[model samples]
Structure formats: structure tokens, C-alpha cells
Target: MYRNNKSNLKLMRLLPRIGVICCIALLLTAAGCSRVEKAEKDDKILIGLSLDSIVVERWQRELEILVATVNELDAEIDVQIANESIDKQTEQIQYLIDKNVDVLIVVPNDANAFYDVLSEAERSGIDVIAYDRLIMHPDVDLYVSFDNVEIGRGISQRLIDELKKKTVNIPEEEIKPFKLLIINGDPKDNNSKLLNEGIYASLQEYIDAGFVTVVDEAWANEWREKIAKDLVEKYLSSGEEIDGIIAANDVLATGAIEILSKWRKAGEVLVVSQDAELSACQRIVEKTQLATAYKPIYDLASTTAKIAVSMAKGEKIIANDSIYNGYDNIPYLKLDAYVVDLDNMDNVIVKSGFHRKEDIYRNINNGK
Candidate 1:
């Protein structure tokens, strides 16, 4: 009876304290609910962007722009890097789907290969924005990227200009032939295919005149430089007197330079490529490589970010240009690119802050 009485007294004392705590907890929970409801009402969207990979510098810049923009709007974004693999890309997209994001921005691993999964995702009410590379599925909501054919044509024409500079003009005498080693990006990427076609088209006149011959051509397995290195090495081992290399991007150009440095001939073999990366600019300064197409990474990345955010906010993004997506004339957010040589390397790349003048001239004139 004594123990029972003491327990009852303690319970009575705790009753008021317990009630206060319970009331406070209930108040806090209600407040949290109200805040959440308000936030939801204010249109703060959550976006999930799954990128193929950061093989080039542009992807990182795009991520920065997107992150900054979302923060400005009091929104959130989830970014995933697939490192250029379809399986990883699929997994990332699935995770985004599970999160119930307001928008899905994807630069598909293979634009044509993800139709089934994208359809499934669409069924769940996800707004899909095909980024950089066009996702060919009929259900894709938005498409954004630079003019791939124009990019290709620009680079090749720049190379032709460079060749003209190096050429010893003769009225009718046969010129010292310049053999080319063409290295394109992944065969599955439609953009890469278009770019290669442009390159070939630009070189057709030279090819017909017997001024250039593609000694060896290669396709990067996954738009990677290592594959390019392997292919370039194989070509070198074949004992072909390669005069110039036409790699599709800066990474491939770096890979080709690695193999070209071991050439059996006398002077540096001319190399041409795209994506004026810092290293590529440095190479140009040293004369180890000839030229690169400085695709305005800033413009594309910034524009993609703005378009993505606009899509999330339900804004207009009508494209100004059109590109042939195999059968259909697909619209595009076309941006311009420039060719970077030693002459304009500073003006084009360094001035844009893509590269530094000091770093580019770190080791020139055989200053190992």
C-alpha cells in the first residue's frame, strides 16, 4: 500500500510536466507541418540531373550554374555523375525517380538506347529534359544542346585554314601529302557521328586532290582519352608516316600527342582537335599540338542551366536553330565555337579564363 501510494504521488507530479511537454511537442509538430506546407506552396522545385560524365570541362561548369540557380530560387537539386556508363546512368535515373523529383535532366549515355526506361519514368509524371545530347524518344519533353554539325564543320574548317598556313603553295606541282589520323568519339553518340560526318565532308576536297589520306581512323570506346591513346599507339606501331591527327576532342588530342611524341620522323606532327582544354592550350603554346576548337563551354553550360531551371519553373525555351536528328529536323539551342591556335590561344581561351597565359607558356621551346 505504501509503495502504491508513492507511485501515485510521483505520477501526479509528472502529470503537469508531461502535459506541458506533450503540448509543446504537438505545437512544434504543427509548426513544422505549416512550414512544409508553406514551402510547398511557394513553388520550390527539386530537380534531378543525371549526367553522362565529366569527360570534358563543360559538364562541371553546367553543374555549377544549375546548383547556383537552384539555390537562388530557394530550390534543391540532386546531381549524379555516371562516368560514361549506361548501367550507372540507369541506376541514377531510377534513384531520381524514387525521390519524386519535379524535373529530370539527363544527358543520356546513348540517346537512342533509353526509350523504354524513359517511357516508364514519364508514366510516373516526371518532366524529362534531354540535355546536351538529344534523347530521340517521342515522349521527351525538352531538348537542349549546341549545333553539333556546325561545331564539327567549324573545327574542320579551322583545320583547313591551318593547313593552308602550313602549305607551301605551288601552282600545279604535287604538294607534300598530309596524311590524317581521324579519331572520333563513341560510335553510339549521334552527336559524334554528326561531327565525324562534318569532318569528312570538310576534308572531301582535300581527299579528292590526294592531299590527305586517312591513314588510320579510330572510335573512342566511351569518349575517353585512354582508348584514343591505345588506338594511336596501334597506329604508330603500324609504321604509317602520319602527318596530322584529327581527334574529336581535347582528351583524344592529348592521347594522340602522347603517341606522336614517340614519332620516328624529325619535326612535330601536326594535330587538330576540339574542346580547347587548358592542357590542349598548353600543348598548342609548346607546338606539340597544332589547333583546337574552343567550343564556348561557358555559353552552353550556362544556357543549359538556365533552360533547365526555366523548364522547372515552367517557362518558355523555344530553340532558335534546327539540327537533323537522323530523320527529323530537331530544334537546337545553337551556340558558336572558335578555333584556338597559338596566335589566338590567348585571345580566345585565356581571355575567357578557360586557360591561363602563364600556365600555357610554362614549358615551351623544348623546355622539358
Candidate 2:
């Protein structure tokens, strides 16, 4: 009986040991699962920014906005500027992919060249946003830009209005077609393409009714100033009667002005430009250029940062009504741009602290 009692106690002790082991196993499994869930939630979303060209004034502004905003959102980002080479952009994108970024923001050198990188990102469940330029493809997830058509039409409307305000000796009925020379932006840029389309849309009204004559329409290669200067010189050499110039961007406008200066054109050739870069604003105030479409880079960059933060946290981003990104409509947000002219130049650009009055007038005052 004593031996039986001892065996019973021993069995009871074994049962408690088994229970403790089972509890430990369950606890370990639960701990492992919790760690995985936390890891998924807490991962730092790596975002890569690939800017096509570093040469333009507006691009630097864009970079500053996006970088500041993304950092503010507590996510990590890597930015690369390709200096306008399509091949360089492609390599930069592939390099970003190799680094395993969770999101990629691309201002592509060409609309179609970066599709391969996008494909890889899509397959890996990474999100991609096309910035400034629209990446026309089937796979891109989000798009952010201003209403480019509106920007174009806006520029045209402003030009037409400004010209109307200028001195006119000809009778309304005897007015010939307002001769317009165009220095279009880089043909490959989707934004420039849209702006061009906008110009046509607005100009067609005057064109079809015979109120406007297109003296020359030259699309710049990579939107280079040298290319624009060369093309403008060629047109001048051709002896076409040119009146006004509608340069798609500030740089192009400046290039056209350089050529016009060689021909001693000031009030004779009205010029339309965009970006409201310090020089562009200065030119407008000095009466060398007409106006610019000022796109608020701060708004765009801040919004992008907010979205990046939400995405990194694996949270949902609210979609505005979808916009067609060439292939199909997708969720997007578009900001508006302002048109700044001499009348509003002090209020719009200089007062906004983008430029200084003394700097603008010093050169003209000295006559150098």
C-alpha cells in the first residue's frame, strides 16, 4: 500500500511537469506570432525619389518640398537626380529597386522608359507614384499633378488678355491674325505634352476663326535653352513675321528673349512663360517677359508626405474621384497653379518672398 501511494504521487508530479511544458510551448508560439505582427506593422517604409533633371529651377523646389514632407512624415526616403538622361533615370530606378524601397516616386525622363522598374515594384507589392510627369502605363498606382490642361489654357488666356491691354493702332476689323511663335517644352514630358494640348485647344478657337496665325511651332528637345536659342535663331533667319512668343516654361521664355534681344525686341514681342522662377518674375517686372504659372510646390510635397506616412503605417488613404492616367482612371489629387503677371507680380511672387525687388532692378538700372 505504501509503494502504491508513492507511485500515485510520482504520477501526479509527472502530470504537473507535462502541463508546464505544454504551457511553455504555447507561450513561445504566441510570442513568435506577436513578433511577426509587430514587425509587419513597424517596418520602415523606404521611399525612393527619382528626379529626371536637376538643371531646372522648378525641379529643385519640388525636391525640397517632397524631401521635407517625407521626412516630416517619419518615413525614410532616398532621392536621386538623373540630370535629364533617360538611361540614367532607368539605372537609378533599378538601383532603388535593388535597395528594396517600399514606394517609388518618379518624375520620369521619358513617359514610357521606366515601366520595367514599375513592373518589378508592382510584382513585389510596392507602390509607385508618378510625380509631375505622367507615367503612361498599365501598372502605375497613383498620380499627383496640377491640372495641366488648365495650366496651359490659363497661360494662353492670360497672354490673350495681356495683348488686348497693349497699344493697338489697327482697327478691330483690320486686325490680322495675332502672330504667335511657340517654344514648346520637351516633347517627351507628359506635362509639357498636356500643356501643348492646352495651347492648341485654346488657340484653335482663334485659329479656326482666323484671328490667330501660328508663325512657328517648335518643340524643344529636353527643353534645353541652347536648343530653344538655336531654333529661335533659325526661325529669325527664315524671316517669318513673328509677333508674340508663348514659351512653355521660364527657361524657354528666357531663351526666346535672348534671341529676340539679338533682334532688339522688347515691347514688340510679348512672351509667355511659367515657373515664376526668380528670374522669370524679375523679367516680368522689368517688362522683358509677360507672365508665369506659379505652381505651389509646398502644397504638392506636403500632400505626398502625408500619403507616404499613411502608407508606411499600413493605413488606408482616401481616394479622390479617379483620374485617367492614360490607360485607366486611378485615385489621385491635383493642385491648382496661379498665373502671375506684372500687375500682380509684386503681390504674387515678390511679396510671397520668392524674389527681391533690389535684385530684379539692379541690372536694368545700371544698363549693363
Candidate 3:
């Protein structure tokens, strides 16, 4: 009985220490579980892409490239196209915000219309990247696109050179001042304004010397082909003899060509185009258009994808240049644009794998 009493006293003394150790272990386990859950949440990121329109081939290609890149980085993306409708685009942006996306990439149809919604995105702690088209808001974090000024200069210079070449057949006395019609892009788009400025800059010397006459200048609403066609048709039927056209893009170029089809097929009118779209490439091959400005879509898309992924993960990004977007100098990644014509089309467009050789040469009798 004395030994049993002594053993009981020792057991009683250790019980409190045992209880204290168990309590500490339980608290530590709960903390560890909370950390694990947080790590899991950080592993998956959702990116929301609110595009203005996938109607253009360039946007469609961008969509594919972005999706592929996001998938490669093990991130999830939800894509929404607004069909160039500002109201629809705004609603889509709100929907993405409600879903709590980590990052938002936008190609706005109308730059001025995004101020309110983008402010909401900023309040929600979601970063916004202006893709291709600069969103003229202070809240936008980044802008990625080709150099619009250079593109405009490229297309205009090439068209001017081709017109000079075509004039060799005309006798100096018979060659009247070349009448050029200017078809500008949507006025709401900042890029279009820059492009127009560049085009005029390139032609300033020619205009001063009376080598070129500007018959008329018109803006294509939303860059719609029908609107562009109507504008060009009005001028074509106005009795002023037009010798060349400076179209803002492939879509606008196509619109003008529909009106100038009879003259273009006869090699009378020269048209300058942009976007390097497949249709434009075909037109170049067929000799219907003079040249198309080529901005490699792959590089733009892949870079955007990588940038979006990095920005979402809070990684540092290196921007080569910056552009002032109404308020501040926004970090920008601006690429250059090249003019593509039949002379070096094989070297730049085909060999670079921008377009398959077979596709560009489909209408040409010989592959070369």
C-alpha cells in the first residue's frame, strides 16, 4: 500500500505537464493547416481577358496565342469578346471583376468609355493591362503594342514609292498631280490618330512640292468595311480622278478596293494597306494592293501572355519604353512595323513563318 501511494503521487505530478504539451501541439497543427491552405490558393491564378472584338483576324490570332501561353504557364483564363460594343464590353468587365480574377487584360473598343469600370477593377485589387489598344485610364498598369507612328510612315512611304514607279509610263507634261484619298480609322481609337499623323508626316514633303494632291480625308467608323466602302464610293462617283489611296488597315483597304475594283484590276489605282492579314496577302500577290504593313502577331501575342502571367505573380517586368496616356507615362512595350511587298514578301513574311508559303502564293502562277 505504501509503494502504491508513492507511484500515484508521481503520476499526478506529470499529468499537468502532459496536458500542457497536448494543448501546444494542437495549436501548432491548426496554424500549419492554415498555411497549407494559403499555399494551395496561391498555386492557381485566374486571368480574365475582355477583348473588344475577335472579328478581326489579328484579335483571333491573339486569342489563340494567349490561350496557349496561359495554359503553358499552368494558369486558367476566361475569354470574353464584346463585338466592339462599349456597353457589352463594360458588362463583361464587371462580370470578370465579380468572379475575382487575379489579372484583367483588355483591348478596348472605345478608350474613353472604360474609365469608370477600370476604376472599379482597381478598387477590387485586380491589375489591368491594356493590350494593343491603350486604355486611356490612370488605373491601367501596362500597355503592349506595335509602334503606330512607324506603321503609318511605313505604309505611306511604300505607297508613295509605288506611285512614283507607276508614273514612269506617263509623259512629264501629261502626268498631272497624283490625287490621293485618305481613309482614316475610327476616330475614337488613339492608334488611328497616331497612324494618321505618321501618314501625313511621311507625305508632307510631297504635298509641299505639289507632287501629291489630297482629294479628301474621311474616317471609317469602327473600321467597318461597309462604312469605308460608302465613303470611298462617294468620292469615286464625285468625278474627281483618284490615282492612289492611303487606307488605314486591311479592312478599310478592302472596302476601298470594292469601289475601285474596275480600276484596280486594270492596274490604274494603287492602294496601300496594313495588318498583313491573309486576305491582304492574297491581294498583294494578285497585284490588287500595293503593300501591307506587317506587325508580327505571334511576337505581340506571346509577349503579352508572358507579361500578363508575370504581372499576376507579382514579378518584375522590363519595359523598353513609356508613353504618356493622358495622365502619366505608362510602361509600354512597343514593337516595330515592317512594310511587306512582292519584292521581299518571301524573305520577311514567308521565311519568317508568319504565313505559310502556300497560302500567300495560292493565287500566283509560280511559287516564286
Best by TM-score: 3
Query: lDDT of all predictions, in order shown?
Result: 0.73, 0.76, 0.83
- Please provide, for model 3 over 1-368, each residue's C-alpha lDDT reduced to its tens digit, 9 standing for 90 to 100: 01243235334534564575556556668566665444454456788999989988888888999999998988889999998899999999999988877779999998789899998887766778888888898767788899998899989998889778867888877767888988999988889988999999999999988789898888888998887678677876776688888889999998888888844432468888789998888888888888999998899888888888887766665578998889778888998889999887889898888899888888787655
Q: Count the backbone clashes (under 3 Å) in each candidate.
A: 0, 0, 0
Q: Model 3 compared with the native: what TM-score? A: 0.87
TM-score of 2: 0.84
Per-residue lDDT for 95-142 in model 1, tens only?
A: 998886767888888978777777766666666777777787755666
Q: Where is model 2 more than 4 Å wrong at Cα?
A: 1-43, 166-169, 318-321, 357-368
Candidate 3 lDDT at 343 equals: 86
Model 1: lDDT equals 0.73
Report how far off residue 253 is in candidate 1 (Å): 0.9
Between candidates 2 and 3, the TM-score winner: 3
Candidate 2, residue 159: lDDT: 81
Ranking by lDDT: 3, 2, 1
Q: Estimated TM-score per prediction?
A: 0.82, 0.84, 0.87
Better model by TM-score: candidate 1 vs candidate 2: 2
Task: Check candidate 1 and list the clashing pairs.
Answer: none
